[model samples]
Target: MKTIAINQYGSAEEFKEIEMAKPQPKSDEVLVEIHAFSINPMDIAGRAGMLGSPFTDNWSFPLVLGWDFSGVVVEVGSDVEGYAKGDKVFGSASSSHSSDNGTYGEYIAVDNTELTHIPDGLTFDQAAALPIAGVTAYYGMKHNLDLQAGQKIFVAGGAGGVGLFAVQIAKAFGAYVATTSSENHRQLLEDLGVDEVIDYHKVSAVDVLHDFDAVFDTVGDVDTGLKVLKSDGKLATIATQPTEEQKHDQQKQVAFQFTYGTGADLDALAELVLNGKLKLMVETMPFSAENVIKAHQTIEGHHTTGKIVIHVKD
Candidate 1:
């Protein structure tokens, strides 16, 4: 099997192509032939040694550089009952308890609980973008918010991968959605049912939005959302934790998002895709060592509209 591994940290150029034996599954695991994988901010951060010695910690040198994968099952362990040979599956390969290493290879062995069967309406490219970005969106907007109809919610940075998902789910939950995007993404945001598309490049959120309900901050800097929130409103952010000063107002709640993958959550996300409610935007790249470098460059560039996926099989 072929794999991309990072020998050292720094630039994307550090990714190198290599050969390794195909991995085998344990009694509770399944072996998947990877079709596609996506790059994420955590991949960049982990590769840069910012995630606390990924080079020497739970993940060793020449680590596999991804976790989001969509693939076909080729083998299943004796303990696995939900999947079989030739089943299509996608999700984070890491188990709930184990968070290191990744799925950037021709084959991966993940616990059966860590993967989900892909529905018939989806493609590998779209499924490949769903694990981290989709779950994070679901966690923040669906799990945390006690949303009600006629209430207004602001999804900050609504043009990015997770932000796009935030916009759709907030609407699905019956909230009037407002979001921040540049002029270029105005139509797209509006098409996603946004009531107001704030041109964040021109003006700040505090200048335009005064809220009565909730705020989902994907762009970090939760203080801006705090400014416009009503005294009893709630603020949700996936980026950084709200500071003490920002949380001083007792009437407003500052919530931090810690998203994790589960089979039920991934299946619900697939249902949204099949039901024509959620569409994951992605830029597909051929899976290669060189393209891995280019994908990292795109992620760090900070202007990606959605997920950047590498088509691993075809």
Candidate 2:
């Protein structure tokens, strides 16, 4: 199978197409023919060699970089159940550090527990866009922040990939939502039921917003989020880690949430999509090394309004 990978981590221009053996399912995995995948900030960070950890320090070159994918199952392991050769499945990979198992390929062998059936109304592109951002937003609001109806919450970077889903999920829970974004995205955020939209360029959220039940920080602006949060409010950040001082503060609750993809969480998100409570905004690109470079460039700008999805098969 043909796959795009980096000979070494550096620039987006380093991407190249190469031929590799098609992967087979492990005892608890399924072999998927990938149809689409989406780019995330982590992909850019990984390409820049900034995500080095003990788990990824020994990775070899020609590393495939991707996380969220939607594809059709072609083979299932003996241990897998409720999935067949023709099932339409989509989910995030459990680990993005694998050199050979990343989703930026024609085929991938993913664990069955991390895969879920794509709901009836979602397209491959939309399903591919949902895994990381959707699951992160869902888990942060539902688990970390414990957001509830009749309360107020503020989301930083409301136009971002994760922020878009956070705002909608808050609204669905009947919470009053306020967010910060550029003027260009104000109308769209309002259409998604945002009660207040602050232009981050002209004014700061700390100046006008206050007394929120929770703060969902998608930008690395935890200080601003803390300033605007009520004394008893909970704050969750996916962008950066909290300082030691901030973590030990007795007054406010702060947490750094790292999302893990699960079939159960994907099912919850699909239910929201089916009920018309969740929507995805995506820009589709053809699968190619050049387009992968272009997509990386667009996401590196840090101002993209929605997810950028690559059509891998059709």
Candidate 3:
């Protein structure tokens, strides 16, 4: 099998392609012939030796680089009950902090418990983009903040992967949504149902907005998000914890540290997709072992409109 992996943890240049043995599923796992995998910010961090060293003994060398995947079940393990061969599915292959390697190859072994059937209407490309970012956005808004209808919710980085999904999900759940983005993404954010689009380059979130019920900061900048929260309101962020000064006026501050894809949550996300309540924003390039370096460079550039996916068909 052909796969892309890291021979060393240094820069995007360190990523290499190799011919590797394909994995067989255990009793609780299903073997998926990967159709597509999407890139995340964490992938760049890992390639840059920022997420420790996945190539070290403390971790694992030649580590697979993707966590989210969508594909068909080529073989089903005996213990898996609800799934079988030929089923279309999508989900994350590991936890957020997982050091167990991942799904950046022609195939991956996924636990049936963590996999979700792709929504009936979505394509493999769209499904591939949903698992990691979709699950994060869903759980972040629905569970972490317990956002209610009519409540004001702010989403920082609204035009990015997770932020785009967050904006749609918040609006679907009935919250008035405000988001931040660059000039090019303002119209896109509006299309996703954002009530207000804050151009980060034009005005600061602190100066232009106030009295928010909750703020979801995907940019990892904690201080800026804290400035806009209403007194005693909850604040959610994927990175950067809010400080004491930032939390001083808030009744509650909840930083959504990490969330992994689950069967139920993925199912809910799929339902939303099937019903047209949510959509996937995909930027795709060819998937090949040799192109891994180029893929990492694209993700590191941070200018993608949404998820960046690699199409792999063995």
TM-score pick, better of 1 and 3: 1
lDDT of 3 by residue, 1-314 (tens): 77788777787777667677787788988988898888888778776767643323345676677778899999988888888889988988754322333677888887865688876778788888887788889998888888999999889889887899999999999999998889898888888778999889989989988988888989987677767887788888887766666656546675645675579988888888888889777777788654667767776777677888888863
lDDT of 1 by residue, 1-314 (tens): 88988877788888888777777688998888999999888889877877764333456666776879999999999998989999999988662222223677888888855479899889998999998888888877767776777889888889887889888877877888988889999999898788899898898889888855898898897888888788999888888988887777768988787675588888888899888888678899998999998889888988688899999885
lDDT of 2 by residue, 79-160 (tens): 9888999999999875544687788889888886567999888888989998989999999888888898999999998889
Each candidate structure's count of clashing pairs: 0, 0, 2
* Candidate with the larger lDDT of 1 and 3: 1
Q: Where does candidate 2 have its weakest 10-residue lDDT segment?
A: 52-61
Each candidate's TM vs. the true structure? 0.93, 0.96, 0.91
Q: Sort by lDDT, best first: what order?
A: 2, 1, 3
- Give the CA lDDT, 0 to 100, for residue 230 in model 2: 91
Residue 129, candidate 1: C-alpha displacement in angstroms: 0.9
Model 2 clashing residue pairs (backbone): none
> Model 1 shows how many backbone clashes?
0
**What is the overall TM-score of model 2 with all chains considered together?**
0.96
RMSD, each candidate, Å?
2.2, 1.5, 2.5
